[model samples]
Target: MEADHEVAPPNLADIDVSAWRELETAATSPQSGFRFLNLCSVDSEARPQARMVVLRRADGPSRVLEFHTDSRSPKWRELSTKPHVTVLGFSTQTRLQFRLQGTVELHAPGSDQANAAWDKLSPWTRTTYTGGPPGDECGFEMIDEAVLPKPQDDAKGKPHFGLLIFRARTLDWFQLRRQGNRRALLTYDETGALAACRWVNP
Candidate 1:
């Protein structure tokens, strides 16, 4: 039995489309809760490493997501050694959670894709890779004034700028609402084709 005003559950087709639309919006909308996600990977010691990363790109059709990082960063090294990773994000506004398991493609600094992305970055943003390698100790004053790439030296951090391209193989999507809760597992094949969809208990 259902209440008169209870809303009907969304069909799988609708959920599939709406979920991707949310991801696309999350990538471009700064205010979106999902704009920042937790990316987790395994280090050499087989320990787990998790960091907050901005969602730089999300292509629903290709099931690909992108994030920028310094090649010298520990996470970059961890990813290079083990490409498999998990990404998680939640939106309080929508009461939605997305957990995606995937592998990553590293785009080196000088690669065509990396170059195009680097060219679009503002000088200030590019300055991040100019300092000493990530995890290096630095004084607050030095971080604020020193180690910044000179404005005219646009190539200063080119060698350290890199991109992590995530190709999701599965997505666990969940939504909570006053009236009802829903969950689904969507699996994608190597070509990014939806191979399976299953609704689960919320």
Candidate 2:
């Protein structure tokens, strides 16, 4: 009997590296073109939770991604328990969408990495994290004001902030066009090296 044969698909390395870089560029641009991602996490009960969040940074070379969130948020708790997550980003301008999956590493306030990132943030951006617990139930007619230390005045207050870092393992890129739908899927190895990639029908 003849042995069965299996055909291997195209590898991610075969795709144009420039195109992948361009996709990352569009995702991280500040013009609101690809600012938001649908962050997906699984709860303790295995229920999925997703929310739209701004993509703060993406280092393509290092495969490191960063996003900010209040330390007191429920997503933090969920992530604390389950470190793996998926981020879906769509760009209307280019009619492209990217889905990324990775394991998360949390950066507590005052850590060296957090400090470096904090130093680069603008005052207005830092103010968001200085507020009270996100999604808290404050009285309708009540206003509670807590004085937060200015970023310049107090260097120690950076610990109150939280930075979530995700090291991506897989990326699914899709392009929607009037003629037809195009898709490409890429996977990276544990060492952040390209494992394989392929173009598939959308």
Candidate 3:
């Protein structure tokens, strides 16, 4: 008689911790495909609004994430009134979906965070915030050339630039699979450290 040997299944703990670390790494890496996420905020009427935003920073130990935006944008008003926001992201390569719920703190033009972020922007990128407030109606007769900033000048956009700092309270991580799905809910303590992580039905 001969005995057969079978391969062991992959470890769950390694997958869980690696998943969290990958998310942070992706957000912080400029070239990463997962560097963008959908930021969801609520309007005064309680309707949900979502938009794509580039992830500027991610700090795992601090449970923080950041993005840049124009102070005149409608999202600024929405976030200012509500503070709390929901962020959704997915990586097609890894088949992972990350849902985060957090409160945002806005840094205005004069604030250090805003100023620092502004200083890092390239001149071409600075032109993005040079125009009038977002969603403003423009007369059809005005030619397209009139609305765009000239290549020579973009300094005026500085004041309109702002930074959004998000303090994540909880993160819901999910990975899809044919055999079985894995999901975990991670909660952060008052000091921003990971307080608890528990697997939930996917």
TM-score for each prediction? 0.90, 0.80, 0.85
Worst 10 residues of 2 by lDDT: 1-10
Candidate order (TM-score): 1, 3, 2
TM-score of 2: 0.80
Backbone clash count, each prediction separately = 0, 2, 0
* Candidate 1 local lDDT, residue 39: 99
lDDT of 2 by residue, 1-202 (tens): 4322223433456443643565467555777556777889998899999998877777776676788876778899999999999988777877778788899998877788788878887776776675557788878655635755566544433557778998989888776765556688888888877788888878
- CA lDDT, every model vs. true structure: 0.89, 0.75, 0.82
Q: Report the lDDT of model 1 for residue 124.
A: 78
- Error (Å) of candidate 2 at residue 67 is 0.9
Task: Flag the better candidate by lDDT, 1 or 3.
Answer: 1
Give the runs in model 3 whose Cα sits over 4 Å from its true position. Answer: 1-17, 28-31, 139-148
Q: Could you tell me which residue pairs clash in candidate 1? A: none
Question: Model 1, which residues run further than 4 Å from truth?
Answer: 1-5, 145-150
List ranges where model 2 is wrong by over 4 Å: 1-20, 23-28, 142-157
What tens-digit string does per-residue lDDT give for candidate 1 at 1-202? 7652377677876777777788899889999989999999999999999999999889989999989999999999999989999999999998999999999999988999999999888887887777789898978777455455677665788899999999999999998766667789999999988899999988
Screening candidate 2 with a backbone cut-off below 3 angstroms (N, C-alpha, C), the clashing residue pairs are: 12-197, 109-159
